[model samples]
Target chain A: MYSNDGFRELERHECLRLLAKVPVGRIVHTRQALPAVLPVNFSLDHDGAVLLRTSAASELVRAIDGSVVAFEADEVDALTHSGWSVVVTGSATVVTDPAEHERLTRTGPSSWVPSPQEVFVRVEPELVTGRELVGGRSLYGVDLTGAT
Target chain B: MYSNDGFRELERHECLRLLAKVPVGRIVHTRQALPAVLPVNFSLDHDGAVLLRTSAASELVRAIDGSVVAFEADEVDALTHSGWSVVVTGSATVVTDPAEHERLTRTGPSSWVPSPQEVFVRVEPELVTGRELVGGRSLYGVDLTGAT
Candidate 1:
């Protein structure tokens, strides 16, 4: 839906599609009553669940083992002054099933850290929303009247 | 301080230094009871306070006003598999003084959104921590034995 200003509010399917284009995003989880954000590499499962790998000793694994968390990703073009950001808020559950864990261990998202990513956490989306900057000056066809 | 793995825990000053290098970061704040993360453009003051401008009607502006939040920024070389991420946890306060607000309004971080960024939020650092992936096989003289 086109929201007020030049921002286009995207639907759930389009949000997931945009997320699939970005490999890295930040996971936000509450710790000690304060929100913490950490960057992670992720992949989407067949059901659109977000798959991630983290070390057993990592703080993120500890905070989001079985909690509601938010994941966000975006792409911005500085030259064109346009970009899109997607947010998926869902329940994060650690993968404990042996067979499932092993499968995820074999085909999980790649980690930038060299540490052994033994913990597999899956975020099942409860809500997904996205917005793209539109109506900006660009080579792409965007109606600039919506520019905020 | 060094951690159990090849990740080097950076000092507070070093964390601030890394944050200065990046113009964009994600702000993690609580909306209702769940944590949310939003990408933002920010600038650091000499005292290390993060300054940002957002539209008056933006959700981030509403959620972060007079609240505690976290800001994170990172850089990773995909091919080299080396990168550093820094997180700054702070209390966000809207700039109220007209003179100060106007000064910040004039000199605050630039926004990619074409909207009128009238609200200025300043995050004063409370906790700063960073980690750098080290010891990877690279021509950049990384200490590889420390690679996790």
Candidate 2:
């Protein structure tokens, strides 16, 4: 468990809270050393899982065919506003058990937009941490390190 | 060639411009299909190729060794409320020639503190595109689809 040494942990939780507000997130994965990032709509399942849906041809299905993956969600506020982000770096294996997958599938509606004939990606979050923007001060950033 | 759909073409140049302005860029690579993003500093050479130094000990050096990597650079503004982003998607191969590697090492100081030394990443712009935000109007997007 590598800790993000960039910012103090006080605002870590805020990052997750902000993530839940935004529906779009970047899913990062690798194929033969090349990093591929795709956008997906996600929701926090509260039962220690993050649920997401995607199409069969979408990149999500291609990458999650039984492999370790990292799911990231973030939001940034630029105005007299504040923002935070939470990234869940964990093993994203496809839900294989029909019952478990069905449970997650039933917890919420699928976010698949292009088609309803796509698979879903559920992240079993191993480590969850976040960062927040406080008081709407001139926004600053900590070096995005140890964030996964 | 897969065109970067969301990346506006004119903003592509702007994204490069910002890369020169800021030494660091967040590089996301996949390890066993998981997304691993790290903070790194890089420079643009005469041909707009991205040059960053690291060694075999560096995570980036290992990831980009022989893969199709996606590199992203973004600028978020809080002043006039505008920002731009650029993404370079291509294959990265190590510059093994002594002259080529040395010339890259001499370009400028690195963008990272407590640097990851000795290796280099050359991102040839196979696809470049960008987008900008302006005023209260719609998003300003340009597609430099066929720019070399």
Q: Which structure among the candidates has the greatest lDDT?
A: 1
Report the C-alpha displacement of residue A128, candidate 2, in angstroms: 1.8
* Candidate 1 C-alpha error for residue A145, in Å: 23
> Docking category for candidate 1?
acceptable
- For candidate 1, the lDDT comes to 0.70
Cα miss at A89, model 1 (Å)? 1.1
Interface RMSD, all candidates in order, equals 8.2, 8.5
- Top model by TM-score, which number? 1
Prediction RMSDs, each to the true structure: 5.8, 8.0
Tens digit per residue, CA lDDT, model 1, A1-148: 6654666877778888988887777777777777777666788876778888777666666778889998888775555666787888899998989999888767777555546446778998777777777635221122211111
TM-scores of chain A across the candidates, in order, are 0.83, 0.73
Residues A67-127 of candidate 2 have per-residue lDDT tens digits of: 5666665444433324444667776765667787677677843443335454556676676
- lDDT of residue B128 for candidate 1: 77
List the pairs of residues colliding in candidate 1.
A135-A143, A148-B114, A148-B115, B135-B143, B135-B144
Query: What is the C-alpha DockQ of each candidate?
Result: 0.29, 0.17
